[model samples]
Target: MTVRMTSARKAILEELESSKAHLTINQIHERLSGRLPSLNVSTVYRSLDFLSQNGLISISDMGVGTPVYEIMKEETHHHLVCSSCKQVIELENDLVAPFFEQIEKEKKTKVITNHLVVFGICLECKEY
Candidate 1:
């Protein structure tokens, strides 16, 4: 289905693309409210829902209180979160691809880890 692009959707997409960190719906609304004053929280939520459903964006809970959203891209990536300090580390696909390959071979099943976030203590926190 072709989703017609609206101003609200455009603003949200722009915000998601520009942001380095994933953001929650309220955070997105807050960022775009100044530029698109007519945009409301409900509109942001709905547009995000539509975009996420269309695979244009991704929504995930990265061991945080609220779920966050980011634009989906061709290159797959994963996150390693420090449970103690709440620090997030981005992991390249190459690093975990081999592990997933072994798992698939052993289990005889395809692994879907699009939103995988492995939680653990970082080195510094672990040493402390």
Candidate 2:
């Protein structure tokens, strides 16, 4: 599906692309507010939803109360978020592919979501 790029969507996409860290809706709005005076939280939310639906961006919980958004990359990966320290560790797709394949075989359904977030205590947190 060809998504019509509006000014708001374009700005939001660019912001996500430029940011190395995941951003919440409010963060996206605040960062763009200076450049786009009319940009609102609602618009940012809608644009994020639209982009995510189109597979252009990914939304993950990352153990945070609010979901975070990042621009989709060619190399898909998941996250293991440390509940204690809030450290995020990247999990490669290869490690998850077999698990997803097993689920697909058993459920007879296609897994569409490429990105996943698992919450747990990291080694450091667990040790301490």
Q: Which candidate is the best by lDDT?
A: 2
Instruction: Tell me, by TM-score, which candidate is best.
Output: 2
Candidates in order, TM-scores: namely 0.82, 0.95
Instruction: Summarize candidate 2's per-residue lDDT along 40-111 as a digit string, tens digits.
Output: 899899999999999999998877799999999999898888999999889999998899999999999999
lDDT for model 2, please.
0.90
Global Cα lDDT for candidate 1: 0.86
**lDDT digits (tens) for residues 1-128 of candidate 1:** 78778999888888898895689988999998789888888888899988888777888888778889998778878889998999999989888899899999999999865656789999999897
Q: RMSD (Cα, Å) of candidate 1?
A: 2.4
In candidate 1, stretches whose alpha carbon ends up further than 4 angstroms from where it belongs are: 98-113
lDDT of 2 at 116: 92
Rate residue 32 of model 1 by lDDT: 88
